[model samples]
Target: MPTYAYRCRECTETFELNRPMSESSAPADCPEGHQDTVKLLTTVALTGSAIGPAASAPSGGCCGGGCCS
Candidate 1:
C-alpha cells in the first residue's frame, strides 16, 4: 500500500491515507467530513549511500545524509 497526502479545501485540513496504487487518483475525505479534497504531492525518503540514480542528486541540507560536515 502507498500513502497518499490530501488537503481539504473546505476546512483547509491536511491528512494522509493509505491506498492501492490503482486508486491513486481517488478523492480522499477529510476528518471534518469534507468531501472537497485534493491529493498533495509527497516525497519519499531513501536511507542509504548515494548510489544509482540518486548519486548525482545534490545534498538536501546540513543535517541531510550521514555526514554533518
Candidate 2:
C-alpha cells in the first residue's frame, strides 16, 4: 500500500489517502460537498545517507572540518 496526497480545487482542501496501487483514484469531495479534487504527486523520502552530506548542509560550512576550525 502507498500513501497518496490529494487536493480539492473547489475548497482548496488537502488530504492523504492510503490504498493499494491497483486501486484507482476516486473523485474526492470536500466536507462541504465541493467536488473539484485532483491527485497530487507523491513524494518518497530517501534514507540512510542516500542524500549525502551536501544535501544535509546547505551552507557547505561543515565539509572538510571547515566549521570546526
Candidate 3:
C-alpha cells in the first residue's frame, strides 16, 4: 500500500492516497474538502533486464571502432 500524492491548497485539488509508509507524512484532505495540503514528489519508472556482463562498446568513435556500418 503505497501511493501518496496530494496537493490541495484550499480548492486547487489533486489527490491520491493509499498510504502505509508510516502515514507517509499524513495530512491530506482534498476531493473538495481541502485542508491546505501539500505532499507530492513521486517518480518511479523501471523496466526489466539488467544484471551482469553485457556492456562493452567504447574504445573509439563513430561506432566503437566499427565506423558505423
lDDT of 3 by residue, 1-69 (tens): 989888888777787889799989978888887688899898987899889989876778766676766
What root-mean-square deviation over C-alphas does model 2 reach?
A: 9.0
TM-score of each: 0.66, 0.55, 0.30
Superposed by TM-score, candidate 3 places the C-alpha of residue 46 at a distance from the truth, in angstroms, of 0.9
* lDDT (Cα, tens digit) per residue for candidate 1, span 1-69: 999999999999999999999999977889999999999998999796755663454676666776665
The 10-residue segment of model 2 with minimum total lDDT is: 49-58
| CA RMSD of all predictions | 11.6, 9.0, 8.8
Candidate closer to the true structure by lDDT (higher is better), 1 or 3: 1
Q: Candidate 1 overall Cα lDDT vs. reference?
A: 0.87
Candidate 2 — number of clashing residue pairs?
0
Per-candidate Cα lDDT values, in order, are 0.87, 0.73, 0.84
- Kindly give the number of clashing pairs for every candidate: 0, 0, 0
For candidate 3, report its TM-score: 0.30
Candidates ranked, most accurate by TM-score first: 1, 2, 3
Off by over 4 Å in 2: 49-69
> Which candidate should be chosen as best, given lDDT against the real structure?
1
